[model samples]
Target: MTRSWIGRRAVVAATFLLALSPLAPAAAAPPVVEAAGAALRPAGAEVVAVTKVAERLTDLSVRSPALGGRVVKVRLLTPDGWNPADRRQHWPSFWLLAGCCGDYTAWSGTDIAKIESLRKVLVVMPEAGWNGWYSNWWNHGAGGDPAWETFHTVELRRLLEKDWGASSNRVVAGLSMGGQGALLYAARHPGMFRAAAAYSASAHPLLNTESINRIMGFFGGQGGDPRRVWGDPVAQRNIWAAHDPYYLAHHLKSLPLYLSSGDGTAGPFDQPDALEADFNRQNKALAAALTQAGAKRLTTNFYGPGTHAWPYWQRELHSSLPILLTALNVRP
Candidate 1:
C-alpha cells in the first residue's frame, strides 16, 4: 500500500498484494499521473476531450431546463489554467457554428480548429438540433421549448462567462445555415457582438420557404408557421428586417463583417436546376445590395472552383481568420 493509491482515492489492500505475490512478485510502481491537462490527448489540430467538464475547458452536454427537452452540447475551448471567475481580460470569443442537422462538435472537428491561433479567444460551439433553427419555435408546440435565441443570446453567454471565464466581447459565426444565424443575431443584437462572419450563409430565410418547411417538418409538422420562430415575414416584417444583414447595412459598417461563399454548382444543397440559380442569385444580390448600400469596412470573398462543403468552409475560415483578428483587434 503506497501513498499513490491514497492520492487517487483507490482502495489498496496489502493483503491482496501478498496473495498475488504467491503467483508473481510485486510489480514496480507506475509513474504518478496528474489529472490536470493530462486528460486530453493532442489530436492534429484539436484537443481531444478526456475528463468531464465540471471544472474547466471540456465538452459539456447540458439540458437547458429553460428550453424544454432540447439539449445543448457545447465544447468549451479554454487556455491552460483557465478560471471562469478570474477576469484578467481575455481575448473575445466567437461561437463557431455548423449547418442544419449538425451537432456542436462539428466546428471543433472541422478545419476551423487550425485557424484558432488566437488562443486567448475561446470558441464555444453549441449544437442546434434537428430544425431548431437557433430561433425559438412558435406556439411551444414542439416540446414547448422557449425561444433558443433568448437561450443563446442571454442565458448561454452569461453562463459561459460566469463559469468559464469567456470574455464578454464575442462574435457568432457559422457556415451555410449558421451563417444566417450569425448575421441575424449580429443585426438583431447590434451591441452584443463586435463582429459577425458567415461563410456561404443562407442569406434570406423567407426566400427559401420550401426548404424551411422541410427543416421544420423534422421538429413537428410540415409547412408549420415560421413566425413561431422568426415571426411572420410579412406581418412581422420589422422583426425579420432586424435579422436581414443586407437591410441593416448601416449597422455593419463599423461592426466587423465577413462573408464568403462557393459557386452554387457542386454542393448537395446546390441542385443544378433553377432552384439553385434562385438561391445563388439571392445570395449574390444580398452581397451586392450590401455593397450598393454604401456599407464600408466589410470584406466579401467568392470562391470559384469550390462547392458548399467542409473543404470549402475550411478554406474560407482560414482566409477569414486574418480579417476577424483585425476586426476584434486581437494581436498574436
Candidate 2:
C-alpha cells in the first residue's frame, strides 16, 4: 500500500510540472485597446435612422495590395443606399481631417457623425498615422514614406469611389494641425478639392519656429531636423513660402476657404497664460496676412470664450455645415 501511495504522488508531481511548462503559444488579443473613460462615450452626432448598409461599420485597417507598404485604417460612414457592386452615380464625400495624435476615428467618435447625418453626404475618416503631417516623408526609406497625396487622390480615392460609390467632386476639412494640412493640400492641388475649411489651424508656421518645432517633433522625432519635411525658413525660402496657405493667397481665391481659430488663451496646449497670448497673436497675424494678400473666396471667424477642443470644433461644424453644403450644391 505504501509503495502504491509513493507512485501516485510521483505521478501527480509530474503532471504539475508539465502544467507549469511554457510550451504553448500565448493567446491572441483583441486589436484595439479600450481607452480609459471610454465606457461612458456617447453616440456621436445625429442622423436620420436608416438600415446599416455595410457590414460591421467600425474601425478597420487594410494594407494596400496596390500601394505596397501603405496601411490605412478608416472609420467609414456608408449612406442609406450604398452598393459596392453597383457603379452608380457617385455621391458627394467629405474626408474627415484628423488632428495631431489623432487617428481616423476622431470624426465618428465625436459628435461629428450626428452632425453629418444632417447633410446628405458620405463622410470618410482616414487614419492619417500619428503625426504623418499628411505630407509624404523623405527619410523613410524602408517600406518607403507615406504617399499621402497619391493615397488620398489616387489609391484610396479610387478604391472608395469604386467600392463605396462616393462622388468624384469632394470637400475636405479638419481641426488644428489637420486644418493646416487640409488648407495646404487644397492650395497645392487646387483641382482635387472643391471646398476646404480649417479650425484653429497652426496656419502661420512660417512666422514662428516654435510651432514648426512642435510639428517637427511630432513627425520627425525628437531633435530631428525640420528641414527634411518643411526645410529651413531662411535657406529654403521658396519651399517654406509654397507651404504657407496664406502665401498661396491666389490659390485661395479659387477654392471655397473657411478659417476659424479660438483665442488659444483657454486651450489645453496653452501654458503660463502668456504663451497662449503669443499663439493667439501669431494666428491673428496669419489671418491679417491672408486678408491683406487679397484672399477673396474666404470666410474667417474668431469665436469668443473658446479654446481648441472637440466641443468647439463640433459647434463650428454646425455653422459651417450649411455653407459647405450650399457651396457644394447639396440641399439642406
Candidate 3:
C-alpha cells in the first residue's frame, strides 16, 4: 500500500477508537462554534444552551465558575435586528436587576419589553439569587462560592460582550433590593455604567439603627444565616460600610443618577392607608449623601405620596428612561 493511503487509514482508525474510548477527555473539548462560525470561548463562564422565548427575548443558560460551576439563567431582550450569529454588529446594554426574593424574570414580567425607546438596546437580566444581595458572600471572611458580584460583573459581563454582541456602553436600573444593587455596582465599579437609577431602594442600610435592623432582617430571610452574608454587623462594620451606597457616594459623584421614592403613605396606587416604607428614609439619606459628595447630574423624584410597589416602580422606569437614554446618546 502507498504511504499516503496508509496514513489516511491510520487516522480514520484512531478517530474511531477515540470515539469509542470511555477514557476520552470530553471535558477538555474546544470552544463552542455558533451558526455563523463565531467561537464562544470556554473561559470563566459560558453559555451552554439557548432558548428563544419570544421574537425579541432569548434565554441563555450559562455555566458559571464563580457560582461553583452552577448553571444560571440570564434573559436577554434583544433590540430590533439583533442577531447573536452576527459578530459585526453590537448594541449598548441595559442591566435590570431583581429585588430580594425575585428572579431574573422580574423585569421581563413587567411591560418593559414593550417600550419603543429600547428598540436599539440590549437588556440583560441576570439571576442574582433570592437573597444574593448583589454581593460576594463574606462567608466568615473565606469569600468563596455564591460570589454574585464576581459572576455578574466579571464572568457574565465578558460572556455577553464577547459572544452575545453587547457593547461596553451600559446603563442600569432596579427597584427595592435591586435598587441597592444598582447603586452598589455603579459606585464600586467606576465608569462601568453610564447612568444608574434606583426606585424605593435600600440605599442607606447603614444609615441608622432602623435601617440596619431592617436589612439585618432581610439578610436572615429564607432561613439563611445572617452572618454568612456580611458577617456580624458590628464585627464586619467595614464590609457593611463598603457595600452601603451612602458610604460610597463619592464614587458616584461623577455619574448621572436618578433617585426616587415615596413617603410610604397611600398615593395613586396604594389603598387609603399604606404604611410608610423604611426605604423612603433610606433613599432620602442616600440622595443627601450623593449631593454632599457633589453629584451634579443627580435627579431626585422623591414623589411624596407613593409607596413601594410595582405600579410606582413601573412609573419611575418611564420617568428615568430619559436620563438613562440621554446618557446612552439615544433619543428618548
Candidate 4:
C-alpha cells in the first residue's frame, strides 16, 4: 500500500508539470487541488443543462453567481472524438471571445471549425453581454451587477476548469470588441493565460481624445450611462486606466501577445464605402505601447486593407493559428 501511494504521488507530480510544459500534451483530469471559497464554486455550480448542437458543438446553460445567478449560455466546440464524460481525459482550453452585439455563436459561424490544430484544444465561447465591455459596470463608481470580468475570469473559469476538460494551459483570442476583451482579460489577470491574440482590437481606447470620446459614445449608445461603465473619465481616471490596455501593457510583458488590425480600407470582404479605421488607429497605438513597455514577447499584423467584418477577422484568426497554437503548446 505504501508503494502504491508513492507511485500515485509520482504520477500526480508529473501531471502537474505537464500542465506547464509546452511540448507535453495535457493529462486527463487535473489533480484536484484544495479549493477555497469561490474557486470551489465550480464544483458546486449546477450545470443546468447541456445540449449537443453538433458532432463537436455543445451548448450549456449555467446559472452563474457572477452574472447575478442568472442563467447564461456557454458554447463549447470540442475537438475530434472529444469526450466530456471520460473523467480521465482533459484538454487544453482555448477561449474565443465575441465582439459587441455578439454572443456564444459568434465564432461558430466562421470557418474556424476546419482548423486542424483545433483537434488538440477545447474551445470555450461565453456570452459577454450585449455591450458588456468584458467589465463589471462601474455604476458611477459605486459598482454593481453584470460582472462580466468576474463572470469570465473567475466564475466561468472555475466552471470550465472544474467541470469541463479544460486545463490550466490556455490562450484567449477575439475580434473587434472581443479583441479588446482578450487583451483586457490577459492584462488584468496576469498569468491567467499563456498568451492572448486580438484581431482588429481596440487596444488603446484612452490613448487620445477622439478615441476617448468615441468609446464614451459607444458606451452611451448601448443604453447605459457612460460613467457607469468605468466612471467619469476624469474623476475616475484610475478606473479607466485599469480598463485600458495601453495603460496596462506592463502586465502583458511576459506573455506571448498577438495584435492584428487593418486600416479600415475596403478589402475583398467589405463594401467600398465602409471605413473602420478607428480600430486600426487603436491597434497601432497598442502595438507601440507594448513595445515601449518592453514587452519581451509580441506579434503584430497591421494588415492595412480590411474593414471590421468577419472575413477580415476570419482570415486573421486563421493566420494567427501558429501563434495561438504555440501559446497553447499544441504546436512547436
Candidate 5:
C-alpha cells in the first residue's frame, strides 16, 4: 500500500486482515485475498472504511449488521476542488444509484462527474445487489443479504454524514431500476432528500400481470425464492405497492421531482432498448399518477425517441441535474 492508501481504505484493509489472520506475524504476510463471506467482519463491529480506487474515486466498505455483518461497498466520487487535508468545509451530496444488473461503477465515465464543473458536492454510488431492486426483501414476510433500503437510507447516510463531511442537503437520482430507487427512497424517507430524479425508471411493477412476472423473474434470478422479495402479486400487493413509485407519489408532493423516459423508439442515439421502452411506459404511467396527485414541484420530459441505454441516461442526467443541484443549494 502506498502513502495514499494510508487513509481510510488502508486502515480498513489492515484491520480486516488482522481480524482474519490474528495469529500471523507481520513479517510473514498472508495472501491478500477477500474472505469467502463476512470472514473479515466479526460480529458487533460497525466501521466504514475507505480505500482509494483512483485519483478522485474511493471504495468505502461498511460493516453492515443489517445484512448479517457483510461488508458493503460504496464508491465515492470526490469533487475536483476537494482536499482531504482540509477539514473545515463540507460537501453537499449527490447519490447516484445504479439500475438492475449494474453495480456501483455503472455511473462512471458519464458526464455526471461534471454536473457542476466546479465540483461543488460529493457523488456517492452505493451497490444494491445486481437484482436487488433497492428494496427490503419480503422473504416470505421474513424481511431481510440485501436490505438495500436500510443500507442506503440509514446506514450509509449516517457513515457519510458523520465521517465524510457530507452536508445535510442532498439529492438522489438513478436510471432504470435505480431510477425507481431514487423515487422510492425519496418518498419513503420523506425529508431525507431535497429532490429526486428518475430516468427510465421501473416505476411500476404491478402495472400488469406480465410486468409483475417480468420483475419477479428478475428477482428470481437473484435468489432461490422469487416470491420472497414481495410475495404473491395478489396476496402481498401492499409490499409491492410500497416499492412502487406510482403508488407512493403522493408522499413526494413536497419534493422536487424530475421524471423522464422515452417511448423506447429508435432515436438519433441508438436503437430501442426493449426493456427501456417497457419501463418507459411504466414511467409514463407513474408520471400520470403523480400528476393526478398534483406533485407540486415535479419536472418531466416524456420524450418518445430514446431507449433505456446509457447515452440517453447520461444525457438525461446532464440535462436534469440543474434541478437537483439547485434544490441541494449546490448549483454551480
Candidate 6:
C-alpha cells in the first residue's frame, strides 16, 4: 500500500516535469502581436495591434508619443500583391485624410475601397482626432501632446515606409477640414506630396472675419477650448497664417494641384432646399491665389451648381484621380 502511494506520487511528479520541459510545444503568440512585431517600429511610435478587417483593409492601432502616448487607429487600403512582411516591396501611397468630426475610417466608409483606379496604390487613412485640425495643438504655448502634425508626418509616415509597403511617391486628397489638412501638409512640407486635391475645402479661412468665426466655431466643438488649438486668433495671428493654405500658396506652386468645389447651391446630388455652403468663396480665393503664385499644373473644376456634400466630393475624387495618378506615375 505504501509502494502504491509512492508510485502515484511519482507519476504526478513526472507529469508535472513533462509539462515544464523545454521541448514542450509553447503557446503561440496572438496573430495581432506577431503582425505588430513583424516590422521595425518608428522612433517615437509603435504599432500595438493590427486587425485584418477585410480583404485589403487593415487597421493598425499605433501608440504615438507625439499624441501624448495615445493609441490611435490608422486604416490601410492595401494594393494587390502588397505584403507588410516583405520589406523589399514599396508602392506609391495615397493619403486620404478625414474631416473634423470623422475618424480614420471615414474614407473606407465610402466606396473608395472598391474603386479600381486606386488598386495599385497604398491608401493611408490616419486618425487626425475629432477636431484635431491636423495641427500640433498650441496648448497655450507649451507645444506638446496631441501633436497631430508630428504624429502623421513624422511617426506614422516613417512606420508605414519602414514596415508597410509605402513608397516615397505620394498624393493627398480630402474634403472639408481634411481638405484643409491635405493642402496644409503639401504646402508646409515641400516635396512631400506628388500632387494635392481638395474638395469643398475651407481654403482661405483667414480671408475675413466670417471665415475666422466659422473656423473658431469648429475649434470650439466637442467641449474643447478654442484657445488650445492655435490660441486666440488675434494674439496668434502669425500661427494662424502659418497654417492657412491660402497664405502658403507660394509653397504649392510647383506641385500638381486639383481644386474643385460647388457654389453651395442645390445641385444634382442635393435636395431642392439645400442651403448654400460658405466654402465656395474660399475655394475661389484659393484657386486665384494658386494661379497667381505661378502654379502651372493646377486644375480647377468649381462645378457651379453643387453643394458641400459627399456625392460632390466622391465625383471630385473620380475627376481628380487622373491628375493624382498621373503625378504618382501610375496609370489610371
lDDT of 2: 0.57
Taking all chains together, the TM-score of candidate 2 against the true structure is: 0.73
Off by over 4 Å in 1: 1-57, 85-89, 140-143, 207-228, 231-242, 267-279
User: lDDT, candidate 6, residue 327?
Assistant: 94
Instruction: Report the error of model 3 at residue 331, Å.
Output: 1.1
- Which residue segments of model 5 deviate by more than 4 Å? 1-45, 80-88, 140-144
Tell me which of candidates 3 and 4 scores higher on TM-score: 3
lDDT of 4 at 168: 79
Model 6 TM-score (2 dp) = 0.84
Per-residue CA lDDT of model 6 for 22-104, tens digit only, reads 10001211111111112323357999999999999999999998887789999999999998899999999999988766778
User: Which sequence of candidate numbers ranks them by lDDT, best first?
Assistant: 6, 3, 4, 5, 2, 1
Candidates' TM-scores?
Answer: 0.70, 0.73, 0.84, 0.83, 0.81, 0.84
* Global CA lDDT computed for model 5: 0.71
Q: Measure candidate 1: CA RMSD.
A: 20.7
Q: Per-residue alpha-carbon lDDT of model 3 for 199-283, expressed as tens digits?
A: 8788987765545555665666655566678666666677787888888888888999999988877798664322235777878
lDDT of each: 0.56, 0.57, 0.76, 0.72, 0.71, 0.76
Per-residue lDDT tens digits for candidate 1, residues 1-332, read 34222133222343122211000001212212122122121111212233455333478555564466455677766654565557774647868776655667666655444444646577777766545566655444454746666566666666666556677777777876677778766766666777778877767544444323322232332333334654444445455455545565555556667888766565543332322233344467577767776767678776543455566676777777776666566764
For model 5, residues 1-332, the per-residue Cα lDDT tens digits are: 22211122112232222112100000111112211121222234255577998867888888876576678788888987776556665788999998877788888767665555427788989888767778777661254445667667777777777667677788999987788899888877767888999988888877764456556556655234556666665556677777888778678777888989888678887765556666777878887888899877888888888876777788888877789888978654
Kindly give the stretch of ten consecutive residues in candidate 3 with the minimal lDDT sum: 19-28
> Which pairs clash inside model 2?
45-114, 46-114, 91-167
Summed backbone clashes in each candidate are 4, 3, 0, 0, 3, 0
Note the residue pairs that clash in candidate 5: 9-50, 9-51, 139-228
